[model samples]
Structure formats: C-alpha cells, structure tokens
Target: MVENSNLLAEQRRALILDEVRRRGGVRVNELTRRLNVSDMTVRRDLDALARQGVVEKVHGGAVPVMEASTHEPGFEAKSGLELTAKEDIAREAARLVAPGSAIALSGGTTTFALAQHLVGVEGLTVVTNSVRVADVFENAARGGSAASPAATVVLTGGVRTPSDALVGPIADRAIRSLHFDLLFLGCHGLSVEAGLSTPNLAEAETNRTFVASARRVVAVADHTKWGTVGLSTFARLSEVDTLVTDSGLPAEAREELAEHLRSVLVAGAEGPATSG
Candidate 1:
C-alpha cells in the first residue's frame, strides 16, 4: 500500500512539473484542483520540486526552472532572481580580487553584481566580454574619487548572446592574446557531472578562452544553479579553483563540491564561511 501511494505521489508531481513547463507557471490552488489532491499535498510536491532544483516557488505557486540544456534566459529576465543571494555571492567573490591584479569576468547576472563591488578597487584592470559589466565600471570611472586611480576596463567585442555576453571569434581572439591573474565566471548551470555549462555554444567557446587565459578561476553562482545542466560544457569542476555561492546551498551539495573544489565559500550576512 505504501509503495503504491508513493508511486502515485510521484506521478502527480511529474504531472505538476509538466503543467508548469507547459503553462510557464501554476498556482497552488489550481494544481490542487487539477491533480485532485489537497492543498497541502500540492504544496508538498512544489516544495519537493524546488529542493530538487527543477522548479522555482513563487508567492502562491511554482514555475519551471528557466534554465534547460538548450534554453537560456536574457540578462533582464535573470537579474530579478535570487537578488539577495547574488549580492552575497558577489560580495564574497570580490574579496578574492587584489588591488593591482588583472582579471577576466564572463557575462551573467551574478558576475554583473560582482562588477559593482569591484569598481573602487585600486589599480585594477578588468577584461570582460559582458557589456553590462563593463558599463558598471565605465559609469563608475566617470564619477570616481580623484584620490584613487581609475581601473582600466577592457570590453571584448563580439556577437552578443541572450545574457548580454559578447561571444564568437572576435571575443575569443582578444581573450587568447591576453593573460589575466584571475577569471570570475558565471554559468547557467553547475553540476558535478557537467561542471560549468551554458546553453549557448558560442558563449561556451568564449568562456573556454577566458578560462585558458587566466591563472586562476572562480565560479560565482547562486544555490539555484546547482544540479542544473546546460547544452555545452566549458570547464569541469576540477578545472575551477574555487566556488563562491550563497548559504542556501544544501549541506550535502556543499560537501560534494568541496571534494572536487579547492575551496567552497558560503556567503552569509556576516561574510563568507570557508569549507574544503
């Protein structure tokens, strides 16, 4: 009886996920009605899906996780998600930067947040393929304090991706010619199996060049990125030196990542706590 009941529940959750993907989003009340399940049951299913990183929970409903192997969301669409977590992760990533080092930043909302924190760093040279990230520094340079030297910002020009990334041969050639002290990368998904992946093939190639040009690489992602897989894999987990993520990442996931990464920093209100 218990086995049959569990199987039935699994079937219901599968249907719920399908509905969310088909309709873009679904309300808890509607799910309960459609599934012929109680409100509490529907909520439980949503919670389970959320924990699996397959769905996002909204105010009174659930939505499909926007990231898929072939689907990439635009910068504006992604900027609104996990705002606090991104801020925390960015804060932690910024600490890895030194005053006089040259670094490369890939395009993503999390890296864009990291750019805001780096504007005031003295004697910094930033090479990026992200228009949004470059703009943050460009705007800051115009209004920066005279006491501090302005950071040099380099924008690698290429065809733009949905996430505002400049990718393709033009960007790749520029990155390959320059070497950076560090690379701060943001990805559509991170899993032990896929490592750092993106939905865009051109962006993946561009990111590969960025990784090759840097002495060290730090991946910046929120908890939601865990377990997600994209169409192309750029770097494996072992290729990255560190990972900076929010505290919301499950303990087991953190532990697994620690085994593969040199350092895993969990960002919090106080600061980032180091593991591995």
Candidate 2:
C-alpha cells in the first residue's frame, strides 16, 4: 500500500505541474477545489512542486516560476529595441530544438523571444532559471493550440535579480546537478577576451554553471552586446558550442571569435556569414 500510494503521489505531482503550466498559475484554494483534495493534501503537493522549483508558492496560490518575479522591463522598454532582429534570431533558435530534447534556457530578453517560438514544438523538456521564460512556456502551453505542451518545464529556484533572473546558491546547485542536452543562454555582455559577461555577479556565476552542465552551449546574443562589458566573466569563448548573434557584429571582432567557437550562427539579416 505504501509503494502504491507513493506512485499515486508522483502522478498527482505531475498533474499539478501540468495544471500550473496550463493556467499560468493556480490558487491553493483552487487546487483544492479543482484537484478535489483536502487543503492539507494540496499544501503538501504544492510543497513538493516548490521543492522542485517549478511553481512558486504565493499568498493565495502557486504561479509558474517565470511569473514569480517581482520586476521586469515595461512593455515599451523591451518592445522598442531590436524587434525584427530578435524575431529573426528567435526563429533560427527554434529550428534548432529537437522534439523530446532536454534543454536549459538562461535569463535574458533574447531567450524570452526564443521561448515564444517554442510554442508549437512537441515533447520538449525545458529547464530555465528565468521567471519570465517560465511564464512564456506556461502561456504557450495554455494556448491549447498544440498537443498541450508535451514538454516538461522545470524552473530553477533562487534569489531574483533586476533582470528577473534566478541566481545564488539554490539555482547554482540545481543547475550543476543536472546534465542538459542543449543550453540556450544569453548574456548582458560578450567579448572575445572577456568571454560571457553579466553586470550582476550572481547571474554570471549562474550562467557559468549552466555552461558546465550542458553537453552543448549556444549563446544567443544580439550585436548590441558585442563590445558591452559586465561586472564578471563567466565562460571563455571556446567553451561555447555556437554563438548566435545578429549581423551587427563587428567584422574584425567576429573574425577573432570565429577562430575559437565550434560554430557561429549569425541571423537577423539576409544570410549567415561564415568564416574559414
């Protein structure tokens, strides 16, 4: 009976994640009513979900971890910059995702765009440390247009940053312990010499751990970040499996980094500019 009950509990936990992803969030009372369980039982399930870093426990209910953040760029601030370029890059990134693959996406505006394009892909398991990214997946799943997002979406827990990125001890430990098939990461700054950079030290460290844990690393950065500098350095240029950027990259600098990375995919223009 004990083993059987444990199995049932696991099934219910899966249901809860599905529901949260479907509705973008659920209140504790709502879960009790909807799942047809006692409040105590619901609390236990929510606790388990919280432990796994998927849904966030709030005053009334649990919301997707991506929407757990207390801050984000306003609509205008984010929409005003690089709209077309971001979309083209997002389309390119989406094409790289294979169904039923385990992927990790880091926090950044560009990654958020990539998440939007993933709505139609089937059987993908996505792990992310960004509250915004999680919400994007949750919304996509809820649109109910496809097979209800066969993807298992997991969020990493930690302190929130200005960019709404989850960082610190919890995130680092969670990322380091898991191995991912592909990691789609973005940065606040990028340079051949400085490698991956972020203004926040904690976020930089968090990105580094994701880099170490993934079998392949794909950096999705816009050209604006090319010469930008940040507070700390995360990974070396050679560590990245692919660098996805816009055509705004400087010819000289792009040539320099091309010698190191496995491949560089430059989108947002007419064609890919490759180096020998």
Candidate 3:
C-alpha cells in the first residue's frame, strides 16, 4: 500500500508537470480543485516536483522552465545580462586558478571569457574543445615576440556542434584520459533533482566525461539558468564545488543552489563590453 501510494504521488506530480507545461502555469487553487486534493497535498507535491527540476513553484502556482533561449546567441551575441556581473564572476572564478595549474574549459561562453582573461597570465596549461577558445589562445600565443605562458593548449578533436563545440565518442575518449585541477563550465538548465543538464544529448555525454575527469567543477552561468531543467543531465547539483552567476538571481534561487553547491558567487556589475 505504501509503495502504491508513492507511485500515485509520482503520477500526480507528472500530471502537474504536464499541466503546467501545457498551460505555461497553473494556479494552486485550480490545481487543488482539479486534482481533488487538499491544499497542503498540492503544495507538498509542488515542492517535491520543484526539487526534482520538474517545476518552478511560484507563490500561488507553478510554471514550466525549460523554454529555449531566444537566439543562437553567437559568441558576439553573448555580451548580454549584467555585464559587470559576468566580469566580476569571471574575476572571482579566475582567482580559483594558480600559476602553473592545468585546467580544462567547457565549451561555454563564460569559459571563453575566462580564456580571454588568461591571455597574459604567467604560466598555465589549458585543454579545450572550442574553436573560438583555441583561437583566443592561438592569437595570444602569436605576439610573435613573447614566450609561451608555460601553457600547452590541447584541443579535443571531434565534429563541432551547432554552438561550435566539439563532441562525440572521440571527444569523450579524449576527456576520459585527461584530468584537470579545475573546469569552468555552464549549462542550459541546473536543478536540484535533474542535476546539470543541457538540451543537447551529445554535448551532455561529452560533459559527463569532462566532469568525471576534473578534480573540481565550477559552473559559470547567469541568474536565468537556475530553476530550469533541460533534456539530458550531465551532473547533479551536489557534484559542483562552486557556482558563479550574475547578481540578478532571485534570493530563493541562490538559497536553493546553496542547498546543494559549496558556494554561489554573485558577480557585481562591472559593465560589459559595449563597442564590441
């Protein structure tokens, strides 16, 4: 009976998720009446669903969160949101690095920014799977007059994703043989229950291998990534050491992340690149 009750609860929760996704959102009162359940039961179900990355609970309702980001948001289109926030997060994230350390960068825009930030840093080695990132380091290495930063960049060889990321069995095997002091990365959705996930399964698989090889995982996302769940999971929230995002994150979202991650770093406004 107890097991059956648990199954029913899960079924109801799925129903709730479907309803919210279908309608975009639903009122608690309406839910209570439709499900013919008590208010407390509805709230409890919503809470559990929220923990699982199935829903984003509002004061009196719940909403679907996996909506797509508007554009491809090309590397050039990435200078949005609290620019200063990204800069601050970038600086703080950079502090996690030490001279002569070996790091791997995930193929995210924030990690790309980190590459630009490391241009003149004394001695560092990085491995990456991004054409843009490789270009950044290649350009910096080309001052034609200076010595290498004790840096040896390894680009994972694979077919590129729509976002210009290299992924597949080749990249996965490459990452399996590698390890890093740290990995700066990001995702489309991160949830307490769903873990770290992205819409692209191929990318998620590659990230799984990447995360498995890193000593520490640092997520560099903005406020919007929270409370969302994506198609395929890469890692659970507890797998992270730190999260750096813009200050615009809701207090509840910060608290929620703090529940699983070691710490949440909110980047202050430092103003973004304008004339770019």
RMSD of each: 7.4, 20.2, 11.6
Candidate 2: minimum summed lDDT over ten consecutive residues — where?
1-10
| Candidate 1 lDDT over residue span 1-276, tens digit each | 011233345445655665676588999988766666688988998997787567999999988876558988899988977788899999889999999999999999999999999988999999999999999998998897889778999999999999999999999999999999999999998899999999999999999999999999999988777777899999999999999998666566788999999999999665678988
- For model 2, which pairs clash? 66-131
On residues 8-71, what C-alpha lDDT tens digit does candidate 2 reach at each position?
4544555565567657888878766666677888789888768645578988778766632223
Best lDDT among the predictions, by candidate number: 1
Q: Residues 136-160, candidate 3, lDDT per residue (tens digit)?
A: 8888887634564536799998878
lDDT-wise, the better of 2 and 3 is: 2
Instruction: Indicate the worst ten consecutive residues by lDDT in candidate 1.
Output: 1-10
lDDT of the candidates, in the order given: 0.87, 0.76, 0.73
Better of 1 and 2 by TM-score: 1
Candidate 1 residue pairs that clash: none
Candidate 1's displacement at residue 271, Å, is 3.3
Model 2 has an lDDT value of 0.76
